[model samples]
Target: MKIRNLRLLPLLGLTSLISLNAAAVTVEHKPTDQIIIKFDNANVEGNSQARTLSTRLNKKLAFVRKTSQGSYVFRLPSRENFSSVKAYLKVLKAISGIKYAEADQMMFAINDLAVPPTEGIVGTKKPIYDLQWHYFEPVGGMNADGAWNQLDSSDSVVNVAVLDTGITAHPDLDANVIGGTDMITAQSISNDGDGRDADPSDPGDWVSRGECYLGSKASNSSWHGTHVSGTISAFTNNSAGVAGVGYNKINIVPVRILGKCGGYTSDIADAIVWAATGEDNPNKAQVINMSIGGAGSCNATYQQAIDTAVAAGTTIVVAAGNSDDDAGNYTPASCNNVISVASTNRAGGRAYYSNYGDVVDLAAPGGETSTGARNGVLSTLNEGTTVPAAPTYAYYQGTSMAAPHVAAVAGLLYVKKPSVTPTEVKTILTSTARAFPDSCVQCGSGILDAGAAIAALDGSVTPTEPAAPSNFTAIAGAGTVTLNWSDQSTNETGFYIEKRRKFSNQWGTYRSVVRAAADSTSYQDSVFGGTYQYRIRSQNSTGDSAWVVSGEVSVSRN
Candidate 1:
């Protein structure tokens, strides 16, 4: 996933009526020949305004067409200047009777593609569970296993639309995939030789040197959409391959928008709108995942599409980009009404390349593979370089990988509470996320806690005690003992540790008690030399959990 730096094309004009304030973290708009504008009235003389502006600027603003959302598209006269579009946008937004105006910025697939191992059976053996550490590991994983326990076939069916390149049929993933639309309108970007079709198969987006823009390097096809889909709903319990966060119960709608050098904001926005109100698709996507983005302020086109989708009860999840800059500088991620997610690594910290800022809504295991492939997010992929090839699996690291974790969990939430609003879904995700175990500045409320999020949706379930701490160990020193264990619950208010004297044949009554604060994982004791054993349990407002006992340890007096 080499990021393609698109050079600015000639300025164009369009009008829109959706008045959205520009994102707070505004930057120079990305180069585009087209602009979307909204006039105060639906049936305004848009051509008249275009003519007057054209006269003032001495450049023709050729009208393209009106959008379903009432915005108008206009192409500007061809020019090589990068600032020409921004300069024209500044002028167009201020024109009388205009409600909103913005450049039709290009969006990109936010990822750093990792190479796959050369020698290994694809699906013969299960993907090592520990290799997929982002799912179950307490320190860095999303704890999706806990959510899987709570989810079953009885839960409502959730449709998740993955707006990415498209899907490559994989033995492990095709079972859950349904028909999707190809939303890329431009043939050059679509790479499929056609525009807007029902078949959503991915035509490889391999680029030659400098094909996207000056200095852009050549790269292979990422098969990014399949990997993302696998993360969301890859077949599980079939005795092979990796497990999905959705537990193989959710349906994946592959909405192909990104291809070649990535996709246009217009196509992505249209896909969002279609997911919301398209009558052609019966299984309306309850959740939409956009693991793609680009540098820019949130614009009216993105905001309006998100608003429309949110109004239709679809929870939109977007990548916070991978630029290591403010996510507010990216479209859709910075757009209002979408849950923007930042990337965390296997160390439970912000990924080195993850974008972060106030606009981020949550964090998830995006993975870091600089050290090894085992550390990255592994999912279904293809062996192709320029076209479709044999299906395979590979590890990919980026905010693109992180967004699906949240999106999959969102699908789980929707399954549990089918009538839940988009805002409520966002609330449960952010509110229930656990505090980051490592430093991740401005990485949203916290890393996503799947089990906690699923449980939070049910108000009637009785409160339960926190899980008992495990892996308890005691190391004895002269007149002292140090005890340590792992915290196993998210609701513990504190921990209660009790110790007993070890006699020749048995242990004495456990009387001595020590209280450790919430989230505590260790405690040291100063004691007279003696043989002893300790037991501990996590406690909360509900009750104390079952106790876990440690092995006996002997101490010597000084």
Candidate 2:
């Protein structure tokens, strides 16, 4: 498969959500009053069996519809209070085949990063690169130009799914955009007179005050999805408004999840599965970008969707949120096995508006709009959605902006190393992350280094069996059981040891003894009590190898 061309590098950057004091701007994601339940024993054996299960579920619940294999969406009658929703879920979960249940939560767009005096879109006079200083100047830029030396171009088939407001028609982005989904359900919010459809067109997400139950002030359409698309593959070197990170041939699969006010977790989750599993995803996305998020925990609904995406061999990249708080408080960003990116300014300092915490994987350029769009991240945009006018380019900020930079980078790496996995993507991105030009507490491993990451892939895949450690020996002394092993693999960077208590000829569950660094072969395993047997395996920068036994040894509390 033809991947991104390393020859024609350097075209774009990412944006970030603005951070603020908890009290200044309240952006909380309230859950919808519905539940998503998944049946454990459900063997999607076929629709015939699922239809039977659905029939049985509809009898007890107010409404039951088969969403996925064993999953169903149900709601209680209005007469019953929402408090009973939990009770109903508990009872449903207790059913023989039922596994788990949770609320159909809500997710919102990264609040407006910058809204400089609203002006109708205008014409482009100067070349796009002249305005996109982030791609050339070092300042707060991500040094993207430097990385293009090693990687830049992309394959046409490698799709990066942009899960946000639907994309708009733009001179630079139109060709790269494949058809996508409109996940908005509410007609009022959709403004498209339909629930969910194939048309991923953005019909002005403008909202009135109090429209969201949050009493939020009215806001105009941000054209966010279009901007993100521009960053990923805005027909590069087109002598147009701006160049995309993934130049010519690279394509985008716009999965519209957020609309009018925002979207529900259920819809967003479904989009992830569809994009990842290639259900309706014609382009076959290798990466998914969710530049929008709201404050919330990692609910089961979001968890299952993400897990499914990962299992489908797709890398999920999410913004760390614009709220200047711990990203841990957000869903998907806090979800397991995702590349949760934080925003960094041109100086590489954590963008003040960017949410930070250990939850962040690495930092990306989520520009500070305060400096104006010229200084902020630049991408594609549209002045009107309904009639589709003012197709121009602009700069925006927020972690929302920053995520696409990484998403585009993931595409670059995939082109270079197709065998790489989601976990490996995270590892390469983080391990190769350059030190922040400035301090960024909880800003993750480091600022994203696109060139370093591509160079680091080095075509290395996890070994089937790195040579096991030899001279494996364990001895007990002075309340401590020290273990030593001889390294045999020249390529290994570390080792993992497991231990089990020897109960006569039988042994108990094997627990991890230690995960030692490459520099250390000897480990001081403190004895808790009794005799124990140990085994170990080697690990490389890629992943772990097969296990090796250390025989048996004894130690006593006395």
Top-scoring candidate (TM-score): 1
> How far in Å is the alpha carbon of 189 misplaced in model 1?
0.9
* 1-558: candidate 2 lDDT, tens digit per residue: 112222222222212221211111125645354567676755434345434544654523334355543476664332233355555556666767667877665566634534543321223332345445444333355545434444433432478899988888887788888868887665656777888899899876777786765446676677788888888888865544567777553579998888776776678888888888988667678999988776667877788788999998999999888778998987778989799989887667887788989898898887776644444677887655234566766667788888898998888777777778998888989998878878799999987776567667865433333577888888887567888888887665456667889776788987544445555678777677788888877654333466778767767774
Candidate 2 deviant stretches above 4 angstroms:
1-26, 40-64, 75-98, 118-123, 151-157, 186-188, 385-387, 459-558
Model 2: number of clashes? 17
Off by over 4 Å in 1: 1-30, 43-57, 60-62, 76-82, 94-97, 110-126, 460-558
What is candidate 1's lDDT per residue for 221-247, written digit by digit as tens?
Answer: 778898899899987755556667887
- Scored against the true structure, residue 501 in model 1 reaches a CA lDDT of 94
Question: Model 2: how far is 219 from its true place, Å?
Answer: 1.4
Provide the lDDT at 166 for model 2: 86
Question: Model 1's lDDT to the true fold?
Answer: 0.75
Q: After superposition, how far is residue 115 of candidate 1 from its true place, in Å?
A: 5.6
